[model samples]
Target: MTSHRYAQWLRDSAFGSLPHPAISIAVTLGYLAALYPGTLPRDTTITAVLTTVFSALGACTGRVLARRSRGRPEEQARRIVFGSCLVILGSAVGMAVWWQNLIRSAVDVAPAGVGWCAAATLPAAVVVVAIVAVPRTAAVVAAGALALTAGLLAPADAGADEQRLPVSSSAQHDPGTLLRGELRVGEFDAAAADLARSWTASGGLSARAVVVAVPTGSGWVDSAAVDGFGSRFAGDVRVLTLPYDQVPSWQAFVSDRSGSAESAIAVVSAVATVLDSVPEHERPRVILYGQSLGAVGADAARVWLENEHPSLLDETVLVAPPAGTVALLSRTPRTVLANSSDPVVRWSFAELWRPHGATGDTHVRGPRVPDAPWLPVISFVQTSVDLLGALDGAAGVGHRYGPEQAGPPHPLRN
Candidate 1:
């Protein structure tokens, strides 16, 4: 009698844990929605994140509705859920073919077959189901175990200082008297003065053109842009970079941006002062170049130039500036390079309600999606999620820009 009672309790518990019919329907719809196309191709990791989030939301909502409606007969619930499953599965198969064709045509990528779709969605669904069906204590324990395993298995990166040491070294070894320096917090004036002195010491006052290449948050100046400058000026120009932060661009973008702004202001000011001392005929053309978060800093410097010294800057090149960041210095000769598929240049809350490509000033680049329709809130959500993999695409696509970023501000037609 005792063993039979124990077996009966186990069976009841298993049956009770089965998801309600509402949950099956909700999660299926949510998972299908996650499979919709976006600006970039969704890889397994991205798809998993989207699937898990949507499924969790659906599961919670379904559980609440089921509880409020009280219980239904088991046979009726089973029939409804089983019928819904067949319909959903059929829709998923059709959606998979359409999704594959859309991504292939739009991005020129190989097919993401139905297998890929299943691989991306199934594991995520299982994980979400485990969390939703398990008791709170068991769920917490599983999550903790997973985190610990990940921490143990994941590779560790070098320390921040170690990563930064190489930037200065690389700049020194690059061609054409490329000078790399750092900006000191609370010592902008002193740093600027020292930078001016360095320009004089390095014989840069004699160059016909000087390019101030502002680095992103991690002090990374694009080598292609530097080489482009050399090609543009016949190796007669001086390229100076004064980097500020040591953290990655995304971290600095979210945490503190004042460093890039302050450094840009100081370096440009210092370079301008030194150039002013030279004879007018001998003064080098001042060209400012920045990419990603660096563009934000360069924009700040442009504003400062407008107020303090109106005609100091000759031209500016900004690559992949964040969404909604406009060029305030309309008077200055400006070149903006943006890829239509670049999430960094298009991710914004405004996309939730309006069409993209509405900006008149931005020059959109190629490898663009041919048929990426902008659907109100869906586009916004997909774009926001795509930010995680913005840099994953090849050069000239998504957030990656090539040496063309260094092309002349105003090109002459052939």
Candidate 2:
């Protein structure tokens, strides 16, 4: 009698856990379905409403089965069988709708492949349901163990290829001249490194040039930027790493306030002070470079320089300027390099700017390629990996921006 009672208890426990596993599976499917971008070709609203309804039904069925099993044994058994069927059917319907719609829409192409691959484990799903319905704790444990083993053995590469590349020694170069004035406080070092690399990669055009690297992200840190690219400039490249920390955060300053413009004004004042201190022949040509969030900083600098210190800036390069910044720096001849696969730039252009009315040339898109010769304006496209790698301080040849492959015999007509 005790053995029979133990067996009954085990069965009850398994029945209770069934709904949880089912709900988990359904939730996973729903998440995967939502990852598909773009509008649904069919009535998305109806499809979405139905998907939610089926998910709720599956959850409710599981709960009813778990509760009914604890009250009347006969009723519990009936509900268990019926509830399992409903849960399975509901999940199937949801999956079928999602799968069918995915096949019909181009946006769903990637997700469809993923979903079909996930659905290949239908046998495992059945085993999960069985384990949940079983009352014996030992049997439930065995089933779980089996499920885990099957999942582990599924065919897939578990590791990624790890490789290393030679590090660039360009991060040790020094600034030939120091612009004497109040430094724009911020992470100037990071921006300086990128500018230095660009200057060096351009065969030393940055030599002896006053490279003004505006700080748009954080406190100015000139060590990284200066050390990275300073050694490659042909002449002494004077780095004026702006310190923009007088404000709270760099992001807040760019988004909420006009601190960047104010910072640019301060930088302009410092540049004038430096130019005045140096002999007429010793003054370097000013080249401005900024990236990512710093692109906004570069924009503010361009506006300030063109409007206030026009004589100081020789050329400006704005790499991946934030949306709406194009107009800010439109009057200044600028080169905007964007990552072809960068979601930030793509979304910003497609959703943000296009919806509103903003007109600015997108120099490059698709993949990160070598820099093209567009006279005073040069645009370089970088791969996502290359861009992220460079940003993360990874030393690699892939991170280097070189000359373009093919283009017109000459640069774009001025």
TM-score for every candidate vs. truth? 0.80, 0.44
- Model 1, position 293, has a per-residue lDDT of 84
Query: How far off is residue 409 in model 1, in Å?
Result: 6.9
- Regions of candidate 1 where Cα sits further than 4 Å from its true position: 1-21, 70-97, 104-109, 125-142, 145-163, 166-173, 279-281, 348-359, 370-378, 408-414
Per candidate, the number of residue pairs that clash is: 0, 33
Model 1: per-residue lDDT, tens digit, 235-334? 8878777767777777777789888788888888987777667677777777777888888888788777777777677877788887776563357767
- Estimate candidate 1's alpha-carbon lDDT, on a 0 to 1 scale: 0.69
RMSD (Cα, Å) for all candidates, in order, is: 4.7, 13.2
lDDT of each: 0.69, 0.43
- Give a tens-digit lDDT track for model 2, residues 33-63: 3322222222333334333433334444554
For TM-score, the strongest prediction is 1
